[model samples]
Target: MSNTQPLAGHVVVVGGGVSGLAAAHFLLEGGAARVTVLESSGRLGGKLYADEIAGVPVDLGAESILARRPEAVDLARAVGLGDDLEAPATTNAGLWTRGRLRPMPKGGVMGVPGDLGSLAASGVLSAAGLARLPLDHVLPRTKVGEDVAVGAYVAARLGHEVVDRLVDPLLGGVYAGNAYEISLRAAIPQLYEGARGGRSLIETVRESQRKAAAARQDGPVFAGIRGGVGRLPVAVAEACRSAGARIETDAPVRTLRRTPDGWEVAFDHDGTRETLAADAVVLAVPAPAAARLLAAESPGAATELSAVEYASVALVTMAFRRREIAHALPGSGFLVPPVDGRTIKASTFSSQKWHWSGAADSDVYVLRTSIGRHGQEADLAWDDTDLVRLSREDLGEAVGLTAAPVAARVTRWDGGLPQYPVGHLARVTRLREHVAKLPGLEMCGALYEGVGIPACVSSARGAATQVLGTLRRAAEPGAGQ
Candidate 1:
């Protein structure tokens, strides 16, 4: 092992997903001598892929980043791709209720009843359901400090109507996990704070609304790259290369070990075994993969990492002639409440949601349907053909598509999204503590904090700063001698 000084040595970033890529980009920008990104697959971006279908670009994995989360936008700007950003066509999404697409109850913050009149007027709740909502005003506030499942929290305050009709579908669409198993505190801290702040959730929401109304406009609601989200990773990779970072695809890390000098990373590249030594290392892979890489040195952390469960999901893209569909696909997308007993969880009007895809005269409509949630038994069972067939059937029934699709594609992600269960934050906190004990090491990915693109970028940037600080400290005399 070479006992080179930390500042003069390399930083190896495991995994080339958005998190890893962002970490490498930050490290390079912070003046790291050499940054090497090791991607497990042939591609750099882990789940971000945009492919052309019938001459139209379709995103298979991540679709858009919330403009409210400035991390992604800032990173785009730093990479010189900020000009390529495009806002979402519409923010209005609805629920498939009673065989009709009903607009989401207005003034509700992700399904929490912020306004009773708006919820009642939306036609989502019955007279009894509307009556149950006011009970929240009188319901006793939770006194426990421990985490509460989203299901219990919403059910207790807003009634089951709010949980089943609104929160479940909205959260299910995003996390793809059971509301009963998701922690309200971990999944949505703002909602939890609001609940704890006042005696009633309705009052809390009213206060939040006032604050939001008073705040100045920040930016767009959501934005995506002109072509697709995949442009983000492409631009990040280009930026890393320009900053003298080495990126190698198909270089899956097999193991990471701490040595007297620094860290050693063993991986395979094109059927050959290779090892690289670095002063610092960032394991930015998914929880499972990162766990495997760090299992030897940080067994406790690795164990906690491996404990985070991931749900398999498949994105089925179908295209049709505009005239072939009966209902006009409005808004960005619509989510199916679990009460609907629908195999399709959510459907995004791809062409209508973005400005780039659809044309007025083309008569082409694209739909991206998501299937398989955490507890929902997958109808297709990981088979691409079956998934596509199920998606088409569900879409046809829901959207009144009488004719077969003009084009169809399926992207299956086995264990793609990490499930943020009830105890997610505590588990992550423990893992972070364990990781901190391991010198020159960091972990960042969708599993730890959030699943969104901006969250991943934020994690990467944070990890990079920590790693850079460690390197700076070690460069001091007698620090790592």
Candidate 2:
């Protein structure tokens, strides 16, 4: 920090996920006198976690980062993981429809076709669906009011088949949300803005693809750490501690009160309660936790947060002997459309996708399948054995893998992904506007902007910057809130 930058009093950051840790990093970098990160869980990293299975280390949570967006990669490099960044060995993916797996069509954004011919060749859509897809080019411009659902808009333009067979599964995999309900503005702002301006929504998607393809000349579209993306929070926590920030695990904040000077936070530690005074507080936790902590200070924000629904998801990671599985498992894996009524939503060929994971055990092939999404919590209610059984069942049908796995592990994430309903962005805006009214209070996390790691980091950076700026100005000769 420069001499001119005032140390923004003590900051107490709730939650020790990647967002909270990243906030601590930025806050300390911006000259906070002190920063204390409180994590309710026994460990950090939240959804980004790694563990060993069958003698091979694999990401049990989120594994990849969208390198097309710079926030995550930038933070990785900033935390001294620049050289550790590695792109996936194969980006090619598949879509399982028509009772078989087909190559995921190229030249599209979120499965919205850019080139109809290629989309047809992929055989992802039926003949009738293909005939309906071109109708988008001649359809009258649809007025997309303030905001609309992604699936609703896409279905209207390209036909319900495309939205059901293509868009839903693609977006569903990312958000764990129903595409018909996820906000167009929040999930795909480019598509929203393009739809508002362009004569044809399909044409707009094609143009967006063209621009993205041209920009890809710089580098790959996605990246992962040499070990796992889970290392991010660990690295960020280390950086924060090195910069004089205190971090505590299993510290669940209980109360948040506005003080005359700043704020007071109460949390439990070692089965005992403790209080911490801070000049500012960052609520970098999930919606439910944030709502509970903010009930006293900002009930409106609390109420709004309470309404933000989340989806539960579970991953079944399995390892099989390379020799036992003679059938070729092509591509990274495949996405299963909900219309197919499948138990597993998607599968990733971990060994084929990441060199680090593959190199762990050359004789073993590692793969993982995800089960559950928005409105599909019941799917995760099954025991680990059931999940593994059904996942293997799907693998048998999809990839002809009948051999029993050498090992399998099920990791369940309750309330893992936050859903972005139609009015989500407006709700977030209102929350921020209300929070801005409270001095020394800020918000950051996946629930606010996006569910991706990069989006969470970006949100944390913005919150940290705003809090630091406010503190710096307050320290001026004649400053007022």
**Best candidate according to TM-score:** 2
Per-residue CA lDDT of model 1 for 1-481, tens digit only, reads: 1123326658999989889999998887777889999988888788888777767887888989878778998888888888878887777887887687788887767687787777877888878888887777666676536678888888877778788888888888778888888888888787778766655777777777788778737678789877788878888999888877899998888878899988989999989999999999998887888888778898999899889888888888888887878777668778888887888889998888888766523777887888888877556475767777777777676666566778888888788889988778999899999999998998888887699999999999889999989888887789755
> What local distance difference test score does each model get?
0.82, 0.89
lDDT of 1: 0.82
TM-score of every candidate: 0.95, 0.97
User: Candidate 2: which stretches are off by over 4 Å?
Assistant: 1-8
Highest lDDT model number: 2
Per-residue lDDT of 1-481 in model 2, one digit per residue for the tens?
Answer: 2233547489999988889988888898778888999999899989999788899888999999999889889889888999999999998899988799899888888988888888999998889989987788788887788899998999888888888889999998899889999999999888888988856887888888777767775788889998889898899899888877899998988889998889989999999999999989998988998888878778898899999999999999999899999787989999999989999999999999999988988899999999999997788878999999999999888989898999999999999999999999999988888788898999999988799888999999998999898788777877754
| lDDT score at residue 200, model 2, on the 0-100 scale | 85
The TM-score that candidate 1 achieves is 0.95
Q: On a 0 to 100 scale, what is the lDDT of residue 310 in model 1?
A: 85
